[model samples]
Target: MCANKKANDDSLIVAIRDLNTHGQGVGVIENDPSGDCQGMICFVDGALPGERISGTLRERKRNYLIVTLDQVLEPSLDRIDSDCRYFPECGSCRLRHLNYPAELAVKEKHVRDLLSRNGLLGHDSPVFKQIMGMKDPLHYRGKSIFPVTSDPAGSGLLIGQYRYGSHDLVDLHDCHIQSRPALALVNRIRELASRDQVTAYDERTHDGTLRHLLIRTGFSSQEIMVVFVVNDRQADEAITSWLPLLKDTIKPLGFALQSSWINDMDTRGNRILSSKYRHLDGSQTIEEIINGVTYRISPDSFFQVNPRQAAVLFDEVIRAAELQPGERVLDLYSGVGAISLQFASAGKELVPPLEVTGVDRVKQAVMDARANAKINELVNLSFIEADATEWLKDYEDNAENQPFDIIVVDPPRKGLDPKALDVLRESGTPEIIYVSCNPATLARDLALLSDVYGIESVQPIDMFPRTTHVETVVLMSRNG
Candidate 1:
C-alpha cells in the first residue's frame, strides 16, 4: 500500500547528497526531519552528489524510493564522458562515467566508510592504507562470458550482457574493458551459431540448445579456453559436429589458436557452468605462471581475472604475512592453492621450511590444487577437500592440528563465516591475512574477529578497474 502511494507522488527536485553501494546517486529532501517520503531520498542513475536533479520515481521499496533522472539541473565536477558506447545500459561497467582518479577516490571513501560504520576505523584502529590502482585500467579483464540469445525480432544471435535490470540480451561489437581477442572469439562464435542454425536458449520458454559462452584467457601465456554452455547432452554432439566448420570460419577470424574447448551443461540456474564438462579439443587445462609458480587452469577454474594486478595483490599478501621459515600456514577458501603454493614455494629460501595447508569446499578445485602443488614441485604444501569451517572444527578437536602460526583467507563475496571467525579466535593463530573482494563484508568480518585480532595493515587493490568493484587485503595480528 505504501509503495503504491509513493509511486503516485515521486516528483521531486532535490540535490544528491551521496552515492549508494551500487554507485547510484542518493538524494534526501531538505528540512524534512520525520519525512521519508516528501523528504525521502531520490536515487538517480546518472546523477552525482551535490548536483540538483529533477527526477520522478521509477521504483519504490519498503523504506526508500528509487528515482529516475528526468533532467539534471546542475552537474557535479566529478562527472566525465563515458568512453564505452553501451554505458549506463550494459550494466557491466558502472564507473565508466567517472574519471579513473575519481573512481579510485570514491572506492577508497567507500572502504573507509564501511570500516568506520562498522566501528573498525579510528586513529588507533586499523591504519587505512592507500589503494593500489592499475596503471592502465582498460582491457584488464581476462574473463568474459557472453549470453547467447535471439534478437528482439527473434531473428539472429544476440551476444552480450543483459540490459540493465532486464533479461533482454543486447549485442556488443566492441567491449573496451574485456580482452580484445576474447571479444573476437565471441563474435566468431555468434557468427558460427547463426550460420549453423544453432538454437539460442530462451529463458521464458526454457527451450533451445546453446545457452551461454564462457571464455578464459591466460594473461601471460596468451592461452584461451572456450566453454559452450548448452541445454542438454545433445548440444555436445551438435557442437562437435560443427567444430570443423567453425574451425574453418573462425580460422580467418583468429580463433583457431585457442588452447582448449569444453561443453558446459548448465541450462538451469545462473551458475557459470554445470559440474559436468565434456572436453572436446586440445588440453583441458592451460598453464599460467604467477609469482614464478605455474598453475594448471581448467575452464571452470577460479583463477584471478586480472593477472597483472593479481601479482601485485599477491605481493602485498606475502609482505603482510611477514612469514618466517618453519611457520605453519593455513589457507582457507584457497582456490587452486595460489596463496598456499606461493607461501610454500617462498619457504625454499627461508631458514626454516614453511608448512602450508589449503582447504576448500570445491572438490574439483582441490584436485586441481593438489595437481598444481605437484607440478610446481612445492612438496611442503598440501590441500584438503572440505569446508574451511568444518575442517577447522576437526582441527580444533584433534591435538595434532592445534594452532597455526599464520592463516590466510580468500572468501567469496559473502565474506568469512561467523563460526569460522570463532574458530580462528580460539585457534590462537597469531596472524591472519584476509584477502577480500567486498569491503562491506570485510568490515563485518573484522568486527567479528576484533575480540582476538588487531588490524596491522589494510591495503586496497584495484582488481576490477573499470567497474565499481575493488579488492582489499588486511593483515590482522592476535590482540594481546
Candidate 2:
C-alpha cells in the first residue's frame, strides 16, 4: 500500500497486517461507515504486523492522513527484541528486530515480486537463487558521515544522524551498524567538538562553524581518512589546532577540510573552501582484496559496501557467463576494476588467456582500474574512461574486432541508461550479465531488453541486510 493516502472525514482504528519496505506498518481500514467503498490505507511507525493500533488524523498537503500509533494489539512471531540501545532511533538498520533467516527470505521475496510485476519472470525462467546474508551484520559499514549541529537551547555542538522525518540532528554516541573503530572516532570527535567550543553549523542563522564530519576506513588495512566540513574558511585556526590533536588522538592516515558557505533565503549553496589536504606518509590509497585480486581505492571511487558478498556476486557472474578461454569480455560501468580484475585473474589460472576491456566515466576510477590491472600483472586487460553509451556507440561503428563474446554491466541504482540499452540491443553481444541494486529498475530494464535477449537466469544476492535493498545479477543470451 502507498504511504500517502487520501483521508476521509470519518477515521477508525486499524490493525497493522504487515511491514512495508520503509519500516512502516501497513493496514487496510475496515467497513467504511460513510458508505465509501474505498478502504483506508495507513502507515504507522513503531507498530508491528498482526498488531492493532489506533490512528490519529493529520493533514499533509491535499491529503488528510492518519499518522499516530496508539497501541500494539498483537505482535508477530517474527518480532524479536532489538539488541542495540538505539534500535529504531539510529535509522540505519530497520529490520534488526527480525531474525536473520527471515530477513533474507523477505528480501528475496521483494526481488521476485518486482521481477514478476515487470513480466521479466516466467515459469521456464531460471531458478532464483536464495538471498545471501552478510558475514556480520554489525560493524559491516566501512564508511559513515556525521553532520555537526548546535543545540538550540545550549552553546555546545552535537554530532550524529538526522532525526526521523526531519532535518534536526540527533547526537549518537554509538551506532551498531558502523565499524567499532568508526563509533569510537565519532565519540572522540564529539568530545573534542564540545571541548574546543567549536560552533556547529546552524542553517537558520548560518552562524555556526562546523558542518559535517566524514569518516572512511579500509577494512583490510585499517587505514582511515577523516574530513572536516565547515561553513567558512575563518575557522582555519580552530581546525589547524584541532587537526594535530585529532591526528594524535585518532591516528588517521589522512586529514582534510571542505568548506561551504550557507546563504540565507531558505535555499542551499556549496563552495569548497580548501582544495588542499594532508595525508600521513603522503599516500591516499586503500587496499581491497576481491576474489584474491588486490585493488587500490581512492577517495571518490565506487566500491561495493559489502565486500564479501560482492565476491560471491562476481563469482555468480563468472559462472553465468560460462567464460571460455581466450574469450573477449567487456565490463561496463566497471568502477575501480573490481569485477574486471577478478575475471582476468581467474582466466590466468585457466588453460587459455582472457581479454578484458573495462569502461567507466570517472577518469580517476579508470586510472585506478588500470593501476589495479598493472599491479595484478594482467597483460590482456585494458581500461578506458568514457561514457558507457558513447563508447558502445563508437564500438558498434568501428566493428574492428569480433563481436564481444560476453558483456557485463553493473549499473547504478537507476539501472542502465536508456541509450546504453539501445546500443546493447543493436550490438547483439552474444551473452549479457546485468547487475543491479534496485529490483524495480532491473525489472523495467529486463522487460525492455527481453525483446532481443532471452532471460537465462537470475541470482539475487543480499548485500544489504536490515534494509529493503537487494542486488541481482541476471544472465541473458541473444534470441535465435
Candidate 3:
C-alpha cells in the first residue's frame, strides 16, 4: 500500500506497535518517499497493536499526526468484532473492538510502560499486580449523561454521545456500558421533549430549552434519578409536567424513579451540568450501598460510575491503607464521602475508632457525604466542605489539628496539583493511598512523590471495561 501511494499522497500505511494514553494505536512513519512527514509519530483510531492499518491523514502536530483509520491491511489476532452498534462513532468505548483479555493486556502494558518511562516501574519498586477485570463488562456503567442537541434536519431532538473529538451527536438508542433504565429514561425524555416542542439547547445560538439529560442508577437499590439540564426557567414547568409520565414510563422498566431534578446550565461553555439545581420530584438524592456502607448520591456528586467495581476498588483502598485503631485518616477529594464512610465502617469496632475526615470542594457532595455519614451511623467520620489543597496547607500551618496517620487522595483526572504534592511531601504522613482514574497523571504525580514516598504496591482495577480508561490504587509509604 505504501509503495503504490504517491510521495505527496495523504494516505499512509503503518504498523501499530502500542496504544496511547487515549487508547489510540500509535505507530511511527518511517522511510517515507516524501521524507517531509517521515519519522513523525502517527496515532490511528480503531487500529490495534500488531496490526497494519492504512489511514487518511486527519491532523498533523509538531511531532505526531492523527489518522482516521481507513482500512486494517493486516488485522491483529487480538482484534475482535465490536458488539456495540456505535463502536467507532459514539467514541465512548475505544477498546470494544478488541477481545476482553487483549484489552486488559493492552491497558496493563500501557500502565507499565508509562510508569517505567516515569521511572516508577523497575527492580526494588512496588509490587505490580495483575489487572483486575470484570466477568461481565457490559452495562457496567451505573451513570450516563447523554448530550441533547437538535438534529441537522430540524425535525426532532437528538440525544446521545458526542462523536470522537467533535460536537456531532451520534443519536444513540442503546449503550453497552450504560444502565438500561437510564437510557430508556433519556429516550422517554426525548420523546416527551419532542412532543412538547422543548428544543434542544444549541451552543451556537444559545437558543433552546434542554441542553443535556443525565441519568444515574443505583445498582443495589435499583433506583434511578433523572436530571434535565436546560437553558431556560420555563423548562421547569414542561419538565415537571412530565414527572408522572416519566414515572409511568420507568416503573414498567423495573426501576424506580426515585428522583427528578432540573439543573439550570444557561452558560455558554462546554460544561454539562451546572451548580444550579431545582428539585422536581421524589427524593433529593438516591442511595447506593457499597460493602454495607450507604452513600447518598446527589445529582452532581462524583460517585463511581461502576458500582460493582467500585466495591472492589474501595476494598483495595481500605486494604492497602492498613487502617489501625485510633489512627486518623484524611480523605481528600472525598466526594460524598463514600471511601471515608467505608473507612469508618471498617474500623468502627476498634477500641478507639479511626478518626476519618472527608474533605471536598463541592457543597452538594459534602452535604451528601455528611448525610451519608450520619445515615450510616459512622460517628468517627466528619465531612468538611473545603478545597483539598487549601485544607492541607491550613493543616500544615495550624498544627493544632491532629496530623493524620494515613491520607487517601482521589483527585480528578488532572491528578494532584503542585501545592498538594508539596504538602504531602512535607506532611510526613506514614501511609498514602492514591486513587487515580488517569494513568498518565497518576504516573506523573507518583514520580513527583517518589523521593519521599516509595511506591508500595500498584493495583489496576478495570473500573471502566471495554474502554481505555483504568482505575488504579497505589499504596505509597514514607521513605526511610
Which segments of candidate 2 are over 4 A away from where they belong? Answer: 1-18, 31-38, 47-52, 59-67, 123-126, 234-282
Q: Write the per-residue lDDT of candidate 2 for residues 255-292, one digit (tens) a residue.
A: 22211112122123544224444343325666667777
> Which tens-of-lDDT digit does each residue in 227-295 have in candidate 1?
888876555656676656545544554444355466656456776577777778777777778899888
Q: Worst ten-residue run, lDDT, model 3?
A: 1-10
- lDDT tens digits by residue: candidate 3, 389-478: 998888877867667899999988899999999999999688999999888999999999999998889888999998788888999999
Full ranking by TM-score: 3, 1, 2
Give, for candidate 1, the lowest lDDT window spanning 10 residues: 1-10
In angstroms, the error of model 3 at 62 is 2.2
Error of 3 at 232 (Å): 2.0
Winner on TM-score (1 vs 2): 1
Residue 422 in candidate 2 has what lDDT? Answer: 91
Q: Pick by TM-score: which candidate is best?
A: 3
Please provide TM-scores, in order, for all candidate models, with all chains considered together. Answer: 0.91, 0.86, 0.93
Highest lDDT, which number? Answer: 3
